[model samples]
Target: MKFAHEFKETLERECFPDHWLAAAIPYSQLKKCLKKVQRELESLGLDKETLQQLLAEQTVSPNGEPIPLVRYNLDHASSRSLRPCLSIFVHLRHGQVIDAALSPASRAFLQRLSGAHSRPSAIDSSACTTPLATPSPDVSSDDNDEDTEGELERIEVPLVFDGEFFNILQTDVDSLDALQQQEEKSMEAEIKSLGAEVSAVVGPPKRLAKSDLNRWREIFDLYVNAQVFFSSHELDHGSRSSVKAVQQLVWFQKQVQTRGLLQSFKVPSSAVAYSRFLQLNATLLQNLKFQEINKTAITKILKKFDKRTSLGASVTFRSAIRSRNFLAGSVAKKLCAQLSQEVVSTVPRAEDYDCPICFSIAWYPVRLRCSHLFCVRCVIKMQRENKKHCPLCRDEGVMNADLNNIDKSLEKFMKQYFRKETEEKQRANEIERGMEIFGDQYKHSSCVLM
Candidate 1:
């Protein structure tokens, strides 16, 4: 299938809002412009073969150094404009060939361009500096400007469509960047508002017997387990693709429904907050799809441009066009970070307060001088064993922590957010202590016959 057709169809099918649709790259227009670029190059007798040979032509200096005869750069004069400069090494004398390696056609083309019409210019040592993998080398490396012969002249090829093509692309990229910024600000505001709304719905327990806080905690736990947009697994550590994001999002929604998490929302506002949260995620996914398709369009057009002109524009164009959120980073990565900091942090999770040594709630949490927390029982055992260093950081603060190390605030926090888990950990600690003191057959007093 033709990429242009596919691009057009996908744009229409995506049903993005009218403004977003309008802001998308004009792939068809760029394609038409690309044809002009091809024609313009061909008009100057610079077809794919001619240009490729010219670009690759090199000559050896008297000191046995290779001097590039031709250099092409997509000189970024400014962020708004990108121009292509083709600098060729040519002898000023009448008919002396600069490089014996260049074919007759390439040699003639170079002579013709270097003759009268094209103005001679010097290659700026800083002009070609970019992050390109295959950039044009700085030819002004010799101590003297002149080689053995009557000096080498540099010619700049004046190209119309080549510049036009990049201008169109770069302008679209800038526009898309602006749109993305606006969308990001809008989405961020929504996320912030949603965080507050969710916080209110799942706030600290109040007069209401069923305040929906526990339900929210459960929902957030499942949402976290879902790992919808990003994954932390060793196998897949980066942002998931839009398709994978869709699948994960669906799984999260299904889990909530299957577990009747939403159905059990005691607070009336909880349902509204949940609905808003789901919609925000959907919007992010929609933006992801739009960004992905447009990114594909840009790649296709650049590849086509390179294939048609043999100018090797794909690499140069990518380096020349600079964008912010649109072409650089994923919205998912940014928004997900914000979500974790703002929204998810509102409903405290048990993992955030777990003892590093036991991987469980740190009831009677003892905070060491190193600032690492551990369950009181684990610390007592460590002190009895004469273990001095902190388990996690290997700091010598473990022995320094005495009765004063017990974090009253953190203990209250654990009890408030993870009451059930903290209570169970306390019982487990009591059972272990009893078993250690009175053989394995001994049980905690709470479970023992009085």
Candidate 2:
């Protein structure tokens, strides 16, 4: 629906009280209504002159009477569209006090008119009209029901106006268009002035030799491609793997250097950049290598890089490619590359050792003093069971040597092995209980038959 129609419908649906729309009545009826309202104003304690002044300024139409001036063009000087408004004016009466009734625009005009003794009679007459004591129209039961159902029929009638509404509409449109056009021209001029100022500071764009420009573009493209690769690879690994993708990313640095991409970009060499890159790659690879990885570590690395980037460090551009610090950065990069390769190579191969406890693959096999290479779970269970001897070797007092400080590889195996044993035992007990219950039920049934 058109915005104007929608707005009108919304206003009607809200059902503003009679007081709000009381101004939309015929001028004659309005005058009659004013008299009664004036009396009510007097009863409210307003003096005679004040009441008259208020009555003269106020506008109110009689009950059930359509306004004589359907469309009011408020100001002749205002844009025609803006002047011809659809709002209704209202006058309020408090006891004997009669308030001046006027639409928002008309009120503003009245304020200006109040400074003068001899104001236009038309304005005064419009404000003070004859009073009508007609009773309000009663809605039919069916109409009331329909209103409750949220439906109201539109009553459209040509709005009676003193002058042509179309003329006012045209005038408003013209004025609005002129204002908008002027604004656009002003904006264009401002932009042109700004561009000239910026050009003066930056100097005219340099004209590079064709060959040099082409080479620079190629270098730029390489850096862009590398950034994209790193971003995608980082997302792919997201704490699910034993290999650090960042380490593999370091390998791309060689290509950047070999192609002289860095020198072309004029980036500064900083040890900090190299150090951070190495540290991040090291952390990632260490976790992967040790099989002691967590999502937090990966997230931390990303956060560090983000911080560095925010600090104006170029981690993924041609500038980063050229620095002397790049050589040091290569170590972490190489490690990442190697780690990635290891992951790919190991994918097809089955794990040689499995956790006896959890029965899953043992990443870091820890051997207990028992000489038994059970997964970490199995060792932990043995310790908890207070069995100092190795489950396999039966060596006594083995748990006394600070089990917490034991090698990670051995701990991993024992943990896994003991977990498997515990699960098996639990399953066996459950089965036994089930059998016992069934036997008792069978016995009870036989006794009942007897």
Candidate 3:
């Protein structure tokens, strides 16, 4: 009980009764009751040494009483009979302190203590007591009254302890600060490493070459002009006015050539050849009035020039007599036939009715006020131009158009047309190369056989 007083006081000072408290006592006893018991024990001259020994032998009670104890014997003939023995010596010295000794039965009973119900009773007054000794009034009543209070106090302690309870509460504040410091150091190291890596990876951006920069500027200008031409061709009056725009493009190409704009860059041989071919076509167009040359004739002239150049042949006649006769005779007849066949093959069928400019076939081929079909490509081309008037028919005003509203059929037609055109071009090139390798030998063999 004296130990219990110190234990309960420790619990209270630490606010042990609160739900938040983590530490707790294991046994039952209130601080007030424990203090009273200790006072009674002291009054009876029961010193700490004597009290400890009595407790060890299980002879002492909560109220400081010593008593005889009993034990059960299963080895005896009568298993139910209580076995009695004296292991503790009670020194009943005259005028000396009554030093109580625990009997063997008492010692055995205490040693066998296990469960809650197996614990010995707290009050045992039937021990060896002198006739002159009387029960202390303060001890008897106080023990009974405080026993109830002690039972309630015992309930205050938690049944289980959470070992990390304190650590968890402090983690958010303390742990974060520590983590931030560590992260700061790590980030500083990472930044230093990154700076070194960046320096090693890229030595200052290289300056642009004069020739390269000029070439880029020319290409950019050409791209801008192409975009504008295509866009204006899409407007309501685009088709009719597109001829004048094409004329301007032809003029621009000539000016670029004559002014030596291309000389600034090291143009590839293939590119120079292609450019010359385009210039030849442009010259032909310039000579023939726009109204006199039909689309079929124009397309034929361009293709003829392209084929002649691809096969390494001269495009022009050496004499005026040869030119005039060829134009007016069988040569003309042959050229027209080839032109007709090529046009028929290249242009989609009326049933297919897709715009050559735009790969779409759905729209009712509405000729723009400029006389251009309203196909997907037409609209895209017009949008690119961003001009107020149609490229083909600038004399007639323009009309606003939205590409999103274009027919789906037209879109499908354009896609298929482009794909087929690409395939045909690839096939044509292969055939041309093959002929170049074997055409002369085949012609010689035919002459020998003849």
Candidate 2, 310-338: lDDT as tens digits: 21112222221222321223223343344
The C-alpha stretches of model 3 lying farther than 4 A from their native spots are 1-217, 226-237, 240-243, 254-260, 267-274, 280-450
For model 1, the run of ten residues with the poorest summed lDDT: 128-137
TM-score of each: 0.89, 0.15, 0.16
User: Which ranking of candidates, highest lDDT first?
Assistant: 1, 2, 3
Provide the global lDDT of candidate 3 against the true structure: 0.34
Return the top candidate by TM-score: 1
Ten contiguous residues minimizing lDDT sum, candidate 3: 152-161
Misplaced by over 4 Å in model 2 are 1-247, 263-450
**Model 3 over residues 1-450: C-alpha lDDT tens digits?**
444354445445543224212212222322223344334434433334443454354333335545432111111113222111112222222222233353344323322321112222323233211112223345554573454222100000011111121122122223323433443354344334433332232221234512222342343355334431334444532322336546656665766676565665443442443354344334323322221222222234224422322211112111101112212322222322332233222333333454554453424333554555554345544666765565555633334555435445654554444444434443544454456778844332112653
Tens-place lDDT per residue, model 1, 1-450, is 898888888878878899998899999999999899888877766777766776677654333456666666787788579978765555544444456555666567767765544333443435542211111244452422343443455556667887788888898888889999999999999999999998887766655466877898888888898898899999999889999999999999999999999889888999999999899999999999989989999999989987887677788877767887788888888988998888988998888888888888887899998888898988988988999998888998767777899999887777677778988997898888888889999966664675
Candidate lDDT values, in order: 0.78, 0.35, 0.34
